[model samples]
Target chain A: MSETPTPDGSPSTWSEDRLHRWLAEQSWPATLAGSRGHDAAVLETFAGRPVLCTDQCIEGVHFELGAGGRAAGRKAVLRTLSDLAATAAVPFAVTLGVMAPRSIEGVPLEAWLRAAITGAHDAATEHGAELVAGDLAMVEGPIALAVTALGHTSSGTVPVGRDRAQPGQLVLLSGPVGGSLPSDRHLEPLPRIEAGVAIAAAGATAMMDVSDGLAWDLYRLARASGVTVRLETERIQPHPDAEDAAASSGRTPLDHGLHDGEDHELIATIAAEDWAAFRREGAASGWHVIGTVEAMDRSAGHLQLRSPEGHSAWLPGAGRGWDYGGGE
Target chain B: MSETPTPDGSPSTWSEDRLHRWLAEQSWPATLAGSRGHDAAVLETFAGRPVLCTDQCIEGVHFELGAGGRAAGRKAVLRTLSDLAATAAVPFAVTLGVMAPRSIEGVPLEAWLRAAITGAHDAATEHGAELVAGDLAMVEGPIALAVTALGHTSSGTVPVGRDRAQPGQLVLLSGPVGGSLPSDRHLEPLPRIEAGVAIAAAGATAMMDVSDGLAWDLYRLARASGVTVRLETERIQPHPDAEDAAASSGRTPLDHGLHDGEDHELIATIAAEDWAAFRREGAASGWHVIGTVEAMDRSAGHLQLRSPEGHSAWLPGAGRGWDYGGGE
Candidate 1:
């Protein structure tokens, strides 16, 4: 904010001019060049139906304060992209809003800010989206980052919704889940963008991202669809991190798999006939059949967890990686 | 976020179901219904070149933490819309990211949050746009809000930019400016969306909204266009609020008119011949021909303030609507 720089080149002294200069040097997408030098970015019409989603991360809320800038930024961008993945949409563009603190664990604020932006920008670019607009401000508080991703379903393909699951449908997960937060795996989530599109293309009827734990998110999906999700506990795959975390947590790895947040994995429900086609085509290769959809009257709650020994329990509404009451 | 309601039915305890129910009842645009009931909002292809812009407001940074909730929301939405106005883009949709503080001036956090969202939602709707997507979070610090607006230039109209002013072009201001912050006028800025379109349609070469003071914005336009703006100091329109403040501030109203922030007025540069057409068509009504654009080498600075007697001085970079020693 000042022209005078500190001897160590602290970022607190990064002027607006320096900020602009840094911005001008980013590897902006070629298609966006025409939109440069303006108050807004101009782009052509989006393909198919335009999808819009916004996600924000706050220090101490979503992540710890000063917990690595690049990690924070990646989490923000990837989580936003995960929302689009829930709908099987193609990434088109993104916009970011940053409210940063003056100091962060003694790291130059500029360096943190730049690393955060680079992380966000790189993640977006890698996922086929371009950063088109951004707004930055330095405030007297914890760092907060917000990202909006504008995307679209492929032509002729309508976006999938959580409310479309049928009672006779099968539920699947793109990969293993759990122990994301304790393992610091939430920081650099691997969004299942392509897998989501493939699953949708394979005729999945309903889908969502497991960002707020499998138990809670499945509850949401089942409630939306007016059906129950009977998660087959024995069939579910818990990540190695979940197993590692279970050692000291006094809970099984399956508990972590069922309740950990920020997995960024896709959970889709499709009819048996559709699943057969999807499997034959190898689209469901690494994906697991973790559950089945059922009528609400057949379960105690919207989401029912069933064990291999014929044991069953209704999970709680809010879930953490550790046990929260519903266990076999 | 509890299901149990207080004796007085406080909003702070409003549950997630209540939030969703509140959202479902909003007067969402008919066009966006396809995007509803999902993690994201979707819409058909935008009308022309798509315009993307983001803006944010933070409590204690942009305004007082307890400032009227509705006013704060309006300011955020209106300011973001102003960027679209600068590019002559028609409003299409908006997505909001809210990081809310628990208690605000004793108003139930829910009430404040609702009022804020209502303010933003209403503003966007009134301007031919829709609030299509939104994300909300409860945080520990100051309430920080972010809004991303997606818009489009009218069909066949390329978005106007800051870097197109040419020599012999006439500079114009949409209306009176200054004293916005002191007068609380910044809280409800009337974006020049329609006028910006008219100017761009009238063949104006360059345009921008006078947000960060006419002086600084003009300097930006000049620098971007690689031209110098010659201001005719007497021709500017000082708002009555500026005049009212000047009486007690001991500075001329024009000083405030020249340097006040958040004016949200449109500034346009047109060739004299084109200006004639704009005037003949009644498009120049209530607009002032404030200056002339000249080659950069023709002036001492990117923006040159010229008096009736030909006395002038180069203005400072960051303007505060106060004297910074550039007075002639």
Candidate 2:
């Protein structure tokens, strides 16, 4: 049989044997015990700091390859970093589990992969993180990238989960809400580390990144806090881009603004009286308040939103939540 | 437009989104999160402690759907846990990364997935490990599984690597040598953890698992240690299964034993004086001595072998290695 072309396009000798030989020649980065030849590699922590988070971004659902490799890489970092941000964690390192197509042969694949890695590096450096271990394999269809980010949080900055929200607290959002849609916004949502850390530092009772839309995420905050939430829909700030898209599409700007997810902004709550001080602290670091928490029947996990027209748009389905099938 | 039909021939709402939602509802067995969603996990030491290793086995490369889900699941876990055996690392915990096709709607797919997890659990438990975290996703094509295993070894046991061999150490092979063709053996090669751990504890100088075949893997051991290695062809041991296949196919048994990769057995070396002790220790563990480690010129990465008929078998291109795209 004729030999298949290699990545370099010469008569390839990458038979199973040749692949082993090639792997043997690579000088692995650090003090890994046996380099890449062993079944599993053992990595040493340089500073006794360990960070780990795994994120899965699917194809068609996450992005199309035509969207450009850099954005895909950036999104990959953001998805993991957002999780880190939710916990007030700082990025330190990352490992990638990339599933690329087997048929997309040659330099293009390598080049694309390099671009993705470069994007990750850029974002990692911005967050003070670095890429460490990586696993690459070729599969049959659309590309998928799974990243595990390692980070460190300063002592005592524990996870400020929604459970910490107290009754009669004021709920706030960072910056404008809802714009990511029909394009790279969903593909490259920003990780709100600065806002999250600031909010935590300012003594916010509870926090979470707004992954789903505002209505749905507020429900999460309500369910976690065992109280009902009251929102002034008229005060619900909208991103200018989202406003333009809704007006042009003949859809309610409120609908698009409140339901259009992928806004990686922080949604936090503080004691009602603490709002001014929190706002002052947040303003110096960049933040905006949107609503407040109230006393509703603890048994009723409901969220109340008053529309601009003095009507209630309290959507029970508003916070459908990012339901992973079967509900783990 | 009509929705896609399920495997059961019903209209399906089994969209990727819906499947993700469904998966999220399934309660997972509680698992210890050593790193609990961090960037990397840490362990105190490696001396005599078990290390776990697992890799995802997707449908196309590892098996086909027609191959039967029961066997496929078993094969997936076996492939991963076998690596632990090679390192003499006792098996402990494993996490699953599954990508299921959305078209295979209904309980059948769920059954297949659960079966695979059950198979993994059984094999792991049999080998002294437990199944831990599992992640599931619905995609557009062939199913893929990523199994990550965690293991710990007993105190005082050292991790035997390819680079730790000393000159004059007798090389040994455990059980069968090769013949895990692209068939059943490939799907079900036995892992040699017991033998590996036993040999290490008995003072085997260096060792490695033979997944890529005797000749190619030995070359790796030699290159890593910066030493030259020469093999005795006649001393090569063949698995009985390979010997039987060779007899019927009119191919030399030696070729199958030395070249065909996927024999997940231990290939180790013990210092000459420790040879008796090694054999005695490995006797209860079931290993066979194969050759010797020698001090020779570095550039002569030659493997010498004498045929059963007292003729040379190391002729150019006579012995084969795995075709890892010809990098060997």
Candidate 3:
């Protein structure tokens, strides 16, 4: 999140009513948020075929509020945009549902809220999406956010999906993964939207975002596509943060790349024939050819790691990078 | 929300993993919420002018969990749909961001979550909107929800906005308001989409929802439109629920009608000449002509209560029926 100026007039007193009035006086997305008269936000005109996605980020569940509201809002929006990237949808607009606690890190609510809303607004603005929504709840619980992103699929390109991978297809990773949590890198997920659009344009068959560790997410894609994905272990490389943390964690950097979650990398699949043309456009440069899709053994798991030493079918949850269901 | 049967196989061994697996096996909006394959929900095609709105419902803040998950879910979706109704937009889709605490009302997390999902699904289906989105957070905090409702404006009818009211226009209320909290009538807000559409077709100048009590919301509309709304006290009628609660409470039924919150009714304005044509279509029935729009004093509040005895300008927060920002 950008370190902009502190909110003007942090409010004489910290009250939800005053916070709302303060929000209205500011120059954010007044059409939807902070305005009392607008019952619901209306986009006067948008005639494209749209795709919608929503995601949640809760303090104490997804991340701590130590970094404050700007980071919180940024992460929430980036995650939603990440989902849109996974779908290869062109980002258009973003909306938020915020449930905020009375205070943030002992600071009054208004300052933090202003920063958070600015964070979301700036992020959406940077990515060509408008931040709009009129929902704000003053809760006594942890700060929770629900971000909904809406977009359109690029013309002539079908939305890349998760269950269309076919046997003999190659799997691609948008970038390196690992150590996002330990290094606090997860807070800055780059939306791989351009990569996704290119992949779809290249006639990619399927795609998924690597929010959960590559191992578990790949397994999900394989199972969904009814195919087995065999990872080329030697080809997988650890991100710089992964290597930086590997020294003290007593684990290999590659281990983190395979199991660490929240990297927000794009995972796409395409026929071997398309691989050459997919890279012809330099925009697809960072993507790594990591694995190949194969026929799945109906009775076994649909994921495998093929190292020089050997290969074996991997089971779900055996090495899950992150399981939100497994309470904090 | 419809009271469907309890979720299947409440997962013998309760765990987030099991909950997820069981959820995937169900027949909800698998394309979004309950599925693992789709990275994001996609409407393959949607070609209309879109209007988007989002709202939040946090347990202990918005409603209590005593009624269980179904009621909670129903109220959340209904609130969102009500916002769309206020905007004069047709409902198309709904998405959720849920932050659930474990063991709602002594029930296991899975059962409550299942019922909650079904509640949202059924409510959206009943309103001609599809419920889709893949975002759920399990927190130890209150069950907080963020619902985003999307739809399009009907062709030929301009979206009834908040800043178009003119002096000498008539202010209309879609239905009765007040005592929603005490009567538990807030749990079932009827979407006034058809009424709003009809009102807009009748060339309504401004619109807002009565989520924040009639006095406050009308003042907001007046401020936005730079006009004053002079309400005729005799013309306003308290809802049956409001009267029922007024018998026990010291306040008058008219007071409750003017101040009570959570009655998701539509407040619209139209030129006095348009009233005849507005009612020409039967769909506009049930709308009450409660007030008239006049030039604002600029110094005083933009709302007034006029009765047989006297007329006085109403302050914004004076005798507020409800203040969400004021915590319980």
| Top-lDDT structure, candidate number | 1
Candidate 1 per-residue C-alpha lDDT over B48-77 given as tens digits, one digit per residue, 9 for 90 to 100? 777889998887756665676687888889
TM-score of the second chain in each model?
A: 0.90, 0.80, 0.90
DockQ-based class of model 2: incorrect
Worst 10 residues of 2 chain B by lDDT: B37-46
Poorest 10 consecutive residues by lDDT, candidate 1 chain A: A319-328
User: Looking at candidate 3, what is the lDDT of residue B320?
Assistant: 71
Per-residue C-alpha lDDT of model 3 across residues B13-110, encoded as one tens digit per residue: 22455555655676656444213437677774554467888988878766787767788888889889888888778888888777776444445556
DockQ of candidate 2 relative to the true structure: 0.23
| lDDT of each candidate versus the true structure | 0.79, 0.62, 0.77
Off by over 4 Å in 3: A1-14, A30-37, A281-283, A298-300, B1-19, B28-37, B298-300
Report the lDDT tens digits of candidate 1 across residue range A1-328: 2333345776443333455557766767557633465788888676687788999988886787557778888889989999998888988889988887555555666767778888888889889988888888766677889999998888777568888888989999989888888898888888788888888888888889998788878877887888888988988899999999999899999989888887888899988998898889876756778889988855467877888677455555344522211121
- Give the CAPRI rating of model 1: acceptable
- State which candidate has the highest DockQ: 3
Q: Which stretches of candidate 1 lie over 4 Å from their true place?
A: A1-7, A13-17, A27-29, A311-328, B1-8, B11-18, B25-29, B33-37, B317-328
Task: Return the DockQ of model 1.
Answer: 0.46
Q: Can you give the TM-score per candidate against the true fold?
A: 0.92, 0.74, 0.92
